[model samples]
Target: MSRAASPDVARNARPYLYGGEEAAIASALSAGQYNHGAVTEEFEQRVAAFLGVPDVVAVASGTAALHVGLLAAGVGPGHEVLVPSFTFCATVQAIVATGARPRFIEVNSGTGCVEPAEVLAALTPHTRAVLPVLYGGRAVDLTPARPTLDTRGVTVVEDAAQAFGSCQGERRVGATGVVTCFSFGPVKNLTCGLGGAIVPRTPLEADTCRRLRSLGIVESAARRAETTTYTVDGFGMRVQMSPLNAAVGLVQLDHFAEAETRRRALWRAYATALDGIDGVALVDADVDRTVPPMCAVRVLDGRRDRVFGELRNRGIGVGVHYPANHTQPAFSPWHRPLPVTERLGREIMTLPFHQHLTPRDAEHAAGELRRALVKADR
Candidate 1:
């Protein structure tokens, strides 16, 4: 199939790279440090500080971050990992990569996140972990289910790929979960061309994750630079972040506060203009706590596809955050009635989102969306 046409207002734009990123990349190139190096360490340290986590290990991609995190947490074959089917397929793929069986679960209709009740009901002796995604940068209150999870000895692997700067109460997602993963992909809130990070709560988990990011080698690239030889005592993969990507991440981190403010404002603009429209309504999320991953609205008139196409015709980009994962052929065996996930798969529509968009752009998108909804209704 031909590539989907880029819209005048992109659904999600590339990271806002500033002069600092250009310099960081240039410095890494001049130093001849292409693989993970001092720059990568600096980026990791900065992320650790931002998330208030003990330590973080940078990786090649968000998927890799999840895979290594599972391994570090000791999830293996015969183990089951509970995850919501409303999220991106990468969450399931990561579980399969570690030889763990993924058990699909329901999400709260309002938040599009897995609720504690659903998780509690799904917990079994084979369940080794629970991967709760912060849907659209909205925080999942794990507190309600923490007691059950703790009693069952289940690890909480937070998928904070879309929630790098978001928080619940005083604690950030990364700081509260057993291990949290963040994505710094091309279109994410914090873009690094391509990179991710694993925030481990303990020193041992951090070391394990660090080794897993590399080829299970005990020593990091920086350490091997000083000495020619390295050792590998555990299984691992070569998923380390490149210095170039790390440089971009560092710059993005530096400017995140300003970018976050702009992103939140744009999200609020959409919420103000789009909420309570005749045929569509914005999904529930805590704007005060979330960094606003995307502006997703639920079409109530069974016309999500029509609205999406109409918006595209008007040069406004739109997207479906995802289809229900359980319905996919690969995960068919795990398929069951996920009423909320299935409904959302058809109702949720993602509008043009990114820090690059302005309040005026948001209003325009909202107006166009309302027109599309009206047309779909007709």
Candidate 2:
């Protein structure tokens, strides 16, 4: 059906871009206070509560949250952080921003999460920590790697950017990691217009993250207002979340549960509708355990480019989740032969699966994909 023929279709055709700035503006205006105020605190508290963590500090971006988390975890120059090559560049950028090196590792093509075995194989004495990305909201099973890290005395910092509400087995992604980071960027499941949060597993780590997030200052806005003077004791960055962003986040939190439910439903609808198609393999959804933040599929038989081009021509906004981070020019120094990561980088594609997409939209996308494949074959 032509989109112009139906208002319902037109409404459903709207792009599922993450975050709504209008809601943020309205909330900011209604609250009156604009800087780091009650809204920011409320957003942090709500995020922490939702993740079942004791503390959550909102920051300017997910990359900022990762930088603060790594700094708090004591990652610095001369140290190495084992990271998956099959992730967004921000993961490596965060490591570099902390003056640490990101040692690239391979990922499993089936799940897109880091291969714990490859991580253990790549470990070195200088490896202080490992940052496993939860790709496409599929939780990286860190249970097996716990022993490896313990043996090496390395911390496990989870990059749960794409898996904010995802669960592994029984526990949520952020609640168990030593220092977990979540991105609320424009495309993330939960967005604050452009923000992120860090959930520390320990009190000391949480305190350190808080300190680092605000310019090495010990006092928060909440604390500063209660006292007369503020003291700057250590080095920190200006990574604190603004009240304006927090206001949007607070509103988003109010609908988080419902949003997640809708996202999952969309994921299922896409998977069910697209399963039998050639040239694409949908990642397995452990619906009973995992809550996928994005719907990812692998384009097979080297047809990725043609498929992507066709989707774009049809106004279906698809995405390549990542290019192998290790292959990026800036990160080439850490690059080794990562065959799986390289292959997946070429094949992986993300479809629109957000709260805004109706089941029919997903089906339409799937139908278009099928047509694209047929055309490519011809």
Candidate 3:
């Protein structure tokens, strides 16, 4: 392949903004409410309603959502959160922020989701929570682990950052007892520039998350606005979402169904084009109810890097969703050998997957990937 300039096909394109976003922003600006206000409340309500959860609290980032949600779920210092080491660093970061330690767990090879068997095996007296990620929006069959998690009194905090519109059976990701956290970053299915939300199962848990997101104030924002005096009742962080971001979130929510349709189409196109390609295999995911966040493939025969380089050379932007967190320097001390995670860490490669990608783009990327495999074999 020529190391030449080619028309760019973005690996992770900026989110497709809804037509109503600008108008929504204009309305918010006209109202002179840039702080976490009514618009933020509306966005939170919209999210809760969409997820079929009791309530939601929008926050600064997905990491913040994880931290506050865990705190609301009674995770704190001296507690251990069993998390998949194959996930983004944010998972462990949030666990640490809550003063809890993250005990790394291996992912199931088929789905890249945290293995329930591993969770059961890793439980300890200090195990306070089990943080399972919905890898690539694929469902982690939590039924098998629920009984054990309940018996041990461990909370299930779902990192559904990549699974905003995904579902397992008829239930949405956040609709269960799990305190699900979602990201609204630039690359997520729903974007608010940089924001996240926590869907709590109970109103009491929602109240706890709300207080923790704000500055632990006794008075709610509505109350603070009505009264002149307020008191700090508990510990909190300044993790509330700005009204501007909330406004964007509201508009995105309005058009999310349409956007999800495009994403699903692109995902299917990639799967169809690359299904039988040698040295490349698709990650297992339930696309029927999934929003198809990303189309990640595992490149085999020691050709992962070669394929990555070739794809880039052809102007097909690609990504490695993660390099195992357990091996990162920050978490190295806690590292234990995870055979499956280690194997997939070297093989997994994310192709250009976004709502903006066309069928032609998918075919071209797959063709280039096939060529790369042949060259690598030679």
Model 2 reaches what TM-score against the true structure?
Answer: 0.92
Full-model lDDT for every candidate: 0.86, 0.81, 0.86
Off by over 4 Å in 2: 1-27, 30-32, 225-229
Single out the weakest 10-residue window by summed lDDT for candidate 3: 1-10
Candidate whose TM-score is highest: 3
lDDT of 1 by residue, 168-225 (tens): 8888878875788888888888899999989887899999998888788998666787
For each candidate, give its TM-score against the true structure.
0.95, 0.92, 0.96
Q: What is the C-alpha RMSD, rounded to one decimal, of candidate 1?
A: 3.7
* Candidate 3 residue spans exceeding 4 A from truth: 1-8
lDDT of 2 by residue, 1-378 (tens): 245211222222232333565777687878777656777888888888887878888888999988998888889999999999998898999999888888988888888887778888989989998999888787777777788798888988888887878887677878775688998877577777788999887888888887888888888777888999999988798888888888767777777777678878888888888989978999765655666776788999999999988888877777888888888899888889999989999998877666667787788888888999999898
lDDT of 1 at 308: 85
Q: Alpha-carbon error at 168 in model 2, in Å?
A: 1.8
